[model samples]
Target: MASAADNPLGTYLRDRRTRLDPAAFGFGGGRRRTPGLRREEVASRANISATWYTWLEQGRGGAPSADVLDRIAKGLMLTEPEREHLYMLGLGRPPEARYRPVDGISPRLQRVLDGMTLSPAIIKTAMWDVVGWNRAATLLLTDYATLPPDGRNILRLMFGNAQARARNADWDSVARFVVAAFRADMTRAGGSAAAAGLVAELSALSPDFDRLWRDNDVVAHNEGVKRLHHPVAGPLAMEFATFTVEGRPDLGMIVYNPATSADAERLHRLLAAAPDG
Candidate 1:
């Protein structure tokens, strides 16, 4: 079933291999005609046989397994997107989602966040890790920047952080819904090892998490009205909607709009009083 169109995979791998600096792989002193790591060197780094890797680059090794492709990706120092590309070209599918902490927002997305001056907006991964937020979001929700990268997880903060628990007007109901939504996400990810590990860690940390996870409840939190007990602004009525970012199904953008004129006025005052960064 192999076609010439898929030849790009072999070409891409070769290009990546040639671009890798040999010095980075501790081959600084060796005399080499090529500017990058040799094929055998890459094979060694990827922990595969030279013959197999050569065959792979020659497009004669047939389709590679996910694990092998992943190793090659690491060996070549591919970015997340590059790794995904390598898998797609080599295996005709993307690799399963793994837990890796990311706190990056594209410049375009950052601008979108900045534009939501009145509405609180946040960008989260499929695993519910808080990666980016606007000023309003920090004022309403917890200040994601203040939390450790790993601690920015919505579920983790909900269950373990006292500050987050205090911000919720209805802790019990919100916690149940959060757990259910998280369960649904985990299920959709095919119950990856990373998801299971997160569940295990949370289960051990919070009794509530343990109970809810065991119950096997699942739901999608597409949109809802949330009552938040803001520390400075007091009670605020907000309607939030979740949207999946185009081309990045792994990310969701949640925006919170004030439900009433009074709430909007209060948010405006709070934002105005705060120093602009």
Candidate 2:
């Protein structure tokens, strides 16, 4: 028999409670004892019995079904990633019921990345793992591929590693954007093992990450400016465009190009001059 401490339902409920704000949920501000929403509030919002909800919080309830967990997630106002995390924890369903990993890229997508000769193009997983990159990307960004398998996370590289500061010109903006993007993904995915693992790993490694994660701020990554101190090109100011690969939910393609004609020429010259390694 598994102990209540090992119960995923209880763990999720507790984590959710820590994430909620009383004022945002319309709870009266007074001499409140608890840190977040009350059990009754969560239960009523979820349309579940208070006793049963309590059991879940106490780690007494077994794994919940997808439908039931979805209701709870809705009641808690969880984002997509958060809901997915709730499910992955065995509080709801298996990975098949949730997300599918992008096993590989199609030839068309590969060609697309390769076709952008003047721009640095790359593909990444939801967890920020680099799935593929073009030759131009290698010349533009140094040591990106040299990272350890699990060290490919942009957030981790930016916050946990000091070397990133030298490589990136606007580290502050980059950090904020990445953190916000991560928060957005968390909401979208509902907190799968991949998400949780990344969060845990980053939190443990970086104090700044721990502080930012606790803020509970959420934002999506769409378009942004990328300032890189390219070894060959010198300082390059680029605009980044990110697009989701259709039929591949786990993969996203990001392309970077100079914002101006002059910078574009510089990028072209830089890539041309670089030795084909």
Candidate 3:
């Protein structure tokens, strides 16, 4: 645990507490010298004693449980990053990740994806749902924009789409790797139970998926070579890597760069030949 002199957890708590609009939370016990809710009011919201909260602010309280910190975080209405920061200050590590469904990426993040004109890039949730992609990805990889909302999942495409399976140069290896990595990602995100329905659905739909899931192999999706035989472009070899989206443990971005200059040229020509371009 970080000491008060260095970590300043108390100072952070006081700052956040004082910055809040007391009236917004239905707190109205007359105005005082300072702003935000009083210590007792905050304690009441957090369901802890006023003395304990005061001691926490004074750095005299002992290390608090994750439950206590979570309550305090909710009471303060902390944002995700703010809650994580609180965990880091109160504890030595971050809190366990809570999986949140990501509807889409930000405009700024979409701009980052769009900027990858040559490199095929995609932003996916921990559950392998393709939430965002660029033109290159659509041309060289799967056309995510045209797919139905449920059809955007990579695993479903891998196991359920015949065209998708046909595109893989080494189908068996890639399929196995995808299954293992998917398992690892969901487990790390603490969403294994949440994904049980998908697992069961795919298991029944594809025998290959059933076999792979039964293997119980877990692997990390870091960097690897991916070969996809695009119908228009023929065999395409790309070096693919997964990256964690900053401050979002539930999201990742994958960028696939052409493996060789020839492949790059082929991609460039393919992009140029697209009717949409």
Candidate 4:
């Protein structure tokens, strides 16, 4: 059987406590032995025994019940994601369960993607899983449909594979942006088993990923530029834009297109000449 020390609940509690500010929580600053709220403080706020809280922090207490955790979440003033994380650590739920998806892409939005015949557009899940794309996107980007399930993760491919590196001209900047974006998602979706699992997998798979994850950085995937070495079109520079799905909050659609008229013409010619594969 796994001990409390091995459990994620304890670690989650410890991490959260350490991150809280006394001023933010309306606590007075005095010469203190520890940085954040003491175990007794959390226990008192949550209406629990100090010993129980201490034992929990020490990784010796039994798993906390949902109701009990709710009390702690309230005491800690946890955000929605933070509350979900507390539950996940105490219990176990996938990350997708924690966040309500935005309004799924409307037909209007679908039409927008379809209208951009010269551009590449793809919709991806919160975990960067590709959900949908237009035919032009498929043609412009590498044949992502042909890749194996695990290999399809854009971040995984960017960092883990040499072939992907060879195709991108500005690999370093792209890598930084990707890591920052992923870190942002992890912050919003922290404590999810799926998200945690993804982080663990990436950390183990690439040393660059391990270094970047340790930085504790975060950023939204709003917009960016990418230069790709297409097999048929050769090198092309493109600007990318991202839009969140309205109903499906967990989905983000990103589109890419050549930044210059000449590049656009080159892309059209290449696509026209390309053989059906």
Which number leads on lDDT? 3
What local lDDT does model 4 show for residue 244?
A: 66
Candidate 2 local lDDT, 1-277, one digit each (tens): 3455677657777778767888888888686886888888888888889887887777666666777777788989987667767777754443322344554567888898888877888888777777678888878874566767666667777887776767899777677678878777666655588788878988898877887788777776788788888766778889998997754556778889798887898898998898877
Cα deviation at 63, candidate 3, in Å, is 3.3
Which predicted model would earn the best TM-score? 3
Given candidate 1, what's the lDDT at residue 71? 89
> Compared with the true structure, what per-residue lDDT tens digits does model 1 show for residues 1-277?
2344658787888889989888777877668887788899999989999999988888886899988998899899998789989988988887765544456889999999999898899998878998899998887787788788888899999999998899899889999999998877666555667777888999999999999889988899799988889888888889999997654657789999989999988888888888765
Candidate 4 displacement at residue 248 in angstroms: 0.8
In candidate 3, which residue ranges exceed 4 Å CA deviation?
A: 1-4, 48-52
Stretches of candidate 1 off by over 4 Å are: 1-6, 27-35, 101-112, 123-132, 143-153, 160-173, 183-206, 218-253, 258-277
**CA lDDT of every candidate:** 0.85, 0.75, 0.89, 0.75
Give the least accurate 10-residue stretch of model 4, judged by summed lDDT: 94-103
- Relative to the unseen true structure, what is the C-alpha lDDT of residue 220 in candidate 1, on a scale of 0 to 100? 93
Clashes of 2: 17
Q: How far is 13's C-alpha from truth in model 4 (Å)?
A: 33
Model 2 lDDT vs. the true structure?
Answer: 0.75
Off by over 4 Å in 4: 1-115, 275-277
lDDT of 4 by residue, 1-277 (tens): 3355686677778778877787776788587888888777888889999898877777676877776887888888888678877877777852342343332346777687778777889877667766566667778775666877566678878888888878888777778878889777656644467777888999999998888888877787898778888777888888999886653546678988788987898888876776655
- Residues 174-247 of candidate 3 have per-residue lDDT tens digits of 99999999998888877766588889999999999999999999999999999989898888899999998877
Candidates by TM-score, descending order? 3, 1, 2, 4
